[model samples]
Target: MTPPIDHAPTTEARMLEIVFPDHTNHLGTLFGGTALAWMDKAAFIAASRYSRRTVVTARSEQVDFKLPIKQGQLVETIARVVEVGRTSMQVEVELIAEDLLSGDRELCTRGRFVMIALDSRGRPAQVQALPGSAS
Candidate 1:
């Protein structure tokens, strides 16, 4: 059975991280892989919170890097479930970078991830119907 999409607030998640030297590259910009990892983690958190079940990444949309994050900057990733299926969810995540000392923030990257909920046996499991939807 498919799950209904819930109100955005209930299935949203946010995470913060500091861009240290280790998280950047030779040019002092955040590594693409590192950014994708952060985005995926944020999506997982949101999907799990929405489904209340073990979730795994199935796939991700092409991510666009709009701005570069420099070292010493603070990064915040916001993720929310945008759609729901029988056992899968689509989460949209956006990464914002802020100057640690200036508080200036900009959107750095954005992506959508597909996560699947798993049962105890590691098979796909259904999620609850969203608010106002027929279960």
Candidate 2:
């Protein structure tokens, strides 16, 4: 079962967006680029929150568009920090689409983002090590 959107555990971030006409493609579905952008933002937030430091996206991987989100639907992007290394974290992001009228929802997209924590001088800095990770 899917967890509630408002339930954010540690190392997790959740964001919601309404799909307007401007965010849609010519076919009236949410634009792929826009979805990716949102997913990246969520990943950034999760990584930053998990490490409590500045973080930057180093890579996005295995992005899969499972379903199309139509305009006027609501999109929830949930990001969680799943793995952490010395200075890098892997965030798993999922985009779920909900019909505003019927309250139906589906998982539309998913991706993994790698973020590197940065020091004040903009160099990679150590992040809090996960329990099983090599610090």
Candidate 3:
């Protein structure tokens, strides 16, 4: 069976937006890349907030696309810190697309991102858990 969804406290914050024509495909659906970009942005924000230092994407888990997001839909991206090491933070991100007019939401994509904290010199630096962070 699929593992239970983790409902732990997220490290960073949540972001939402309504998909417009600029973010849509020729078929009038949100493109996968658009969603992926948003996920990455959300992950970066979370990691930066947790590390208190500049962070860079070290790796990205393969994205699984579950449904198509239509134009004029509201897209919500949730990102949470799942694991923290000496200098690396693992962020789990999920993108959900909702039709505000119809109140329909779908899981558009999910992925994990590994980010490494950077020092002032732009080199990998040690990271500490932020205040109010869940252990």
Candidate 4:
């Protein structure tokens, strides 16, 4: 039998209107590096919410740019924690570009980020399991 879909409450974090200038790009659109930076920031928020401690990116599964974001568009990023390991968490981040006048929104990029919790001394730290998170 197929497993039930997880409808657990996802902690949503949003960043709005974080401008990216044209100089930070090789193409006219937003640079891939800039997208990655935003992804990291979003993932950090998700991971810290789940782990309740500082966390760092351990890996990026894949980042795919579905659409381009222009320099003048308003960018909004949302992150959600999807899974957790002993000391690591997986976060899904989606970047959307919104037109201020028309209120149109388009998904610009998406990726899964793996983050590991860190202690005060910067060592790997254990993260408490959320209810219904056990495998």
Candidate 5:
């Protein structure tokens, strides 16, 4: 028989979004809150895909914005599970901004989010650990 649904390693997550005028500030750069929302979405995708369960963000670590994302820049966010507990998982998220014209990319944001799995009753629930995780 095939292994169960939760018997696999987590698939890494990558999301891409373009910085538009609507998402920018008077300085013509992406707003900090918008960037953070993208990072949080990336983390949620990673966690939900891994556990295949309803997950919610418990907290996010200090976010660092290394570079600015200007209008028309492409932002790519990558997320991976770095740690796990009985009911929580820590996802490391990194956002990169690229100037498509020049093909230059820089790390723009970095943060770690703690996501908690929830049962049908909305209480903490155990998540199946990654196959080879030390947890």
Candidate 6:
């Protein structure tokens, strides 16, 4: 039997990481490049799950690092597919930092990633359109 179809546009992906020494900069805070890598991974997972196909990051937009996440903190990344085009998905990703001891949490970074689905031959492939979307 065929699998069920998901028409909803609420597909999301979440991930958690510990800010170890390797993931931090000399200032004892999470490195910007490491944070972006984690966010991109979240976006990739979200887009792949939503499209049920292989997806690649096309671009990232408006990445704002509002707070410095200190080393030894916990980081939570949440990614959701906010829009869908003929062969692409716009995934919004946010990173939240939490103090392991006090349980304090704050939004540290946010960005939008564009992912494109690819076929077996590495060409852009059409994906299911979002509800009410013209694609």
- Candidate 1: tens digits of C-alpha lDDT, residues 1-135: 989976557689999999989999999999999999999999999999999999999999978999899999999999988888889998999999998778889998999999999999999999776666554
Better of 1 and 2 by lDDT: 2
lDDT (10s digit) by residue, model 3, range 31-129: 888888899999999998777799999999978888888888899999988888889999999988888978888888889999999999999999876
Candidate 5, overall lDDT? 0.90
Better of 2 and 4 by TM-score: 2
Where does candidate 3 stray beyond 4 Å? Answer: 1-10, 129-135
What is the C-alpha lDDT profile of model 4 across 3-87, one tens digit per residue?
A: 9996534455677754567525756678888788888998998888778899999999988999988877888998888888889
lDDT, candidate 5, residue 90? 92
How many pairs collide in each candidate, listed in order?
A: 0, 0, 0, 0, 0, 0
List the global CA lDDT of all models.
Answer: 0.92, 0.94, 0.87, 0.84, 0.90, 0.94
**TM-score-superior candidate, 1 or 5:** 5
RMSD of each: 6.8, 5.0, 8.0, 7.5, 4.2, 4.1
lDDT of 6 by residue, 78-126 (tens): 9999999889999999999999999999999999999999999999999
Error of 4 at 51 (Å): 1.2
Q: What is the lDDT of residue 54 in candidate 3?
A: 93
Q: What is the alpha-carbon lDDT for the whole of candidate 1?
A: 0.92
For each candidate, give its TM-score against the true structure. Answer: 0.88, 0.90, 0.85, 0.84, 0.89, 0.90
Q: Largest TM-score belongs to which candidate?
A: 2
Worst 10 residues of 2 by lDDT: 126-135
Output the TM-score of candidate 2: 0.90
Candidate 2 C-alpha error for residue 131, in Å: 4.4
Model 2: per-residue lDDT, tens digit, 35-134? 9999999999999888889999999999999999999999999998999988999999999999989999999999999999999999999988776666
Worst 10 residues of 5 by lDDT: 3-12
**Regions of model 5 farther than 4 Å from truth:** 1-9
| Residue 44 displacement in candidate 1 (angstroms) | 0.7
